[model samples]
Target: MKNNILNSLKNKFEQTKTEEKQIQQYFSTFDFASNEISESDRMFLVEKEQILIKQGKVNSDSLYQICITLLEVSDRFKNNGERKFMKWYEHIGLNKDRVSELLKRAHLYINYPEKKNLISSLPTQSVKILTKKDIELKEVQKILELGYTAVMDIKNNITNLNDDEKIKMKSFKYFDVKSIQKIQKDIKKMDSKEIFNAKKEIEIYKKLLKEAEKQLEEKEKDYDNQNNLKLLEAE
Candidate 1:
């Protein structure tokens, strides 16, 4: 009975692995961007900016960073403020023109807070730049976390199918040889720029995965054939 249970569990595990492989194969044709931006990338940029800012030599790159940070904060505040503005506008039944004006003012207020008077006076100036930089870094971190959540959701969706169900779905879809050929032709003819981008991304990921697998295989082989004799001699 224990042996039977173990075999059953092994079979289930193999089935799951097969299903995941099939799902990956289907998406193998689809290309997606790397979708990974390391925390180190952001930290390096922050450090570079800090050096330039401290020197009080505002280069175009530093200015660009400042603009991007402001834009990100402005977007966040605008989105939140718009929701609140809409609610109040509906509650008060404000005139359409008045509401529009209020929204414009709200955006300006959010993007350019009254507290940062010195920074606003000289937007290009880098004095006390660390405060703004910290805010931007936090926003970038939040955005990265949100992106990770989205990727996890996609991964969950892809891996949720059972082996039999996946096989059946693939089989039924490709039942007629002619129909399968036509579908392939249609996919070939699909001209969306996004599709092309996805295809490129998929190829890149496949190459990366291939390299990783090769390295793993080499490591496994090395482990299996490790020089135990040499180790004993050393001891």
Candidate 2:
């Protein structure tokens, strides 16, 4: 009986491994950006994107493929214009902002196909920030070396600081009340650009705080209901 169970488990594990390999192969070879776009190819890309979204487990490689697929079809969706591709992405369960980000990254990757491995090595947020405008490969490397806080500073138009100052900015927690108060006290010392960036950070924090409060309130309600059900069951 033990031998039979062991063989069954081994077979299942192998099967799963094989399936993963096949999926990876498919993504690798898929003609995601073919010039000769046919209806079947279009549908294939759409189905793959839908599956990726449904699985809710998108890593960097899969995300890169998704961007390529969207960038390809986007041209045909809105009178064959990529600029108007925003409406169709909503149908595929992506918000406008997310679709824009993916498209920008795709454009950057397509423009510099040689740097794909380097691009893929970075975080998705970092990639999004890097691709917001026309940037050189060397510039991307420089910003990456400076680290996350520096990248965020660039995102907010805080460009006057040196590398050390940019790196030091990461020490403060964006959502900490005490940190915000300290920043407030030091606001008078900041340049105009730094002031603008700080205000933007505060605005983002306020939005996040509201979202966290909402989620917490919902969880508390769920906890209370679960407790009430337990009390009734114990009666």
Candidate 3:
């Protein structure tokens, strides 16, 4: 019975592999960008995209490929291509948000081919978190080590925190003394005008820092008062 089950699973895997190959072959030959491409041909691609989406595990690479194709097809449409794309995308019964995300992932895949291995290996949500506008490449590599759920949780927690808490959480990273020193050290390379601009910027930053410190002190005092009230209540 176990052998029978194993053989059945093997057959199903083979069938999927065959289907993927045939669809990919079709994709390669089809002039999806041609203005003359029929509605039936467009629907064929849509059907294939739906099949991939409905799979138990949609591979990141396949999803990105389909997104790229869909966008390309949309561009090929002479009139209201974007509108047509949206109509087809909705017809596939996918979330518009999800479509936006997949397109972003696909663009990231194209733009950062060096990081393609890392991006393609992660789930869509993890990719979304890692590719945030403010997340640098080093941070992406570090969080990639934590795996999908951890990356998502870390970003979600950061997002959910209050402004003060967010600032506190990222304070260490934001205040990289070494980076500051590097900028200071590079000041020697600046010409007079550049140096003047840098000095002005430094003054502005100093004022900002002083304001932040004052606000922090106020918050700390409020926190202490809250703690004291809690202690009195307990008493």
TM-score of 1: 0.19
TM-score of 3: 0.34
Model 1 / residue 17 / CA error / Å:
49
Q: TM-score winner between 1 and 2, please give it.
A: 2
How accurate locally is residue 18 in candidate 1, as Cα lDDT from 0 to 100? 89
Clashing residue pairs for model 2: none
In order, the Cα lDDT scores of the candidates are 0.42, 0.60, 0.60
Judge candidate 1 against the unseen true structure and give its global Cα lDDT, from 0 to 1: 0.42
Q: What TM-score, over all chains together, does every model reach?
A: 0.19, 0.36, 0.34
Model 3 residue 187 lDDT score: 81
Deviation in Å, model 3, residue 101 alpha carbon: 1.4
Residue lDDT tens for model 3, 1-235: 9999999999999999997786555443456767576788787776776576445234444545665675566557637566777776666554466566656666666666665545655544555665677666656554545443333254644433345533443468547666567777988799999888888988998788768755765665465345334423543
Model 1 weakest lDDT span, ten residues long:
122-131
The residue ranges of model 2 lying beyond 4 angstroms of the native Cα positions read 1-61, 77-84, 134-137, 141-235
Q: Which candidate gets the maximum TM-score versus the true structure?
A: 2
Model 3 alpha-carbon drift over 4 Å, by segment: 1-60, 74-80, 135-149, 152-235
lDDT, candidate 2, equals 0.60
